[model samples]
Target: MDDKIILAEESLKRNGFQVKIFNNSEEAKKSLLESITTDESVAFGGSMTLSQLEIYDDFKNRGNEIYWHWKGEDRKKELAEAYKSKVYITSTNALTLDGKLVNMDGVANRVSSMFYGHERVYIIVGKNKISKDYDDARERIKNIAAPKNAKRLNINTPCKFTGKCNDCDSPDRICNVEVIIHRNPTGANINIYLIDEDLGY
Candidate 1:
């Protein structure tokens, strides 16, 4: 095991979070599918990592009530149901070695759901998303994660062209709100699944 993964897992456990480790994304996806039941409703955050997993169709086919603004025709309705779903699935932008989870959002529905309104929260992270410290984690979010997301969403931001954060005042900026979770929220059973390979930006 990588030293950073070990440290992050131990630190997360100490912070009252359940940590699961996998060698790759396939294992993580398989475990998540097993852990969540069709009887329970599932919601998705606006995360590229979640998109990579591509489990939405499977969940829907198995008769799990699904809520994801990215997939549903009525985004507003999906976002509302996601806020109060039985399970919330998402990924963090960055996870520090000391166990801090960091993320920035444009709309904030995804970030807010992590703190409350769900009985269970599953955060799947790739090893490459882990940083040495909090500052580095935040930097990774601004420089790497935010820029890539801007390009994907085709948001007219300066960073979209530069491939770096310009801290612009554009109306379409995607990183308006940032959150750093130092400890697990009391309202949900938070589970952190760490994969060894790089998965998302």
Candidate 2:
């Protein structure tokens, strides 16, 4: 286990987040599937980590009501249903050592759901996404997370081509909204699952 990840877990726990450390994504996936009940509807945000976990398919096959925009053509309808689901699972762009979750979004749905409209929100974080502090977290999001996601989605944004944040004025900008969660949202149980692997951008 990396020292940084351990430190982050301590800090996040101090800040009132339920922190769990895993050796790898496979272990994390096993635990997630076992813990997240079929009785409660589950929702997922746009996350490479969750995609890699193949949780949507696993849950769908298990007869759990699932909602994710990436699953079908009805993105708007799916997004609405996702927000209303009992359990919300997603990932943060960056997790600071001092206990902060930093994220940037285009559609704003994922970011909003992080702090609202869910009985429980599970944040799956890979070791690569950890940072020293707030500034470092946001920096990585712009240069690393945002750019990679833009390229993956084939968006016509400068970051996608430049492999860095150009801070372009394009209407298709992925970082249209940003949020920094200093603590868990009111009336929501937030779980932070920290895996020691480079799972997502």
TM-score of each: 0.97, 0.97
Q: Residues 116-173, candidate 1: write the lDDT tens digits.
A: 8888999999888999999999889889999899999898999899988988899999
- List candidate 1 segments past 4 Å from native: none
Candidate 1's TM-score reads 0.97
TM-score of 2: 0.97
- In model 2, the Cα lDDT at residue 63 comes to 93
lDDT of 2 by residue, 45-140 (tens): 999999888778889998998999999679889998998899999999999999899999999999999889898889999999999999999899
Q: Candidate 2 — what's its lDDT?
A: 0.91
**Pairs clashing within candidate 1:** none
Residue 65 error, candidate 1, Å? 0.5
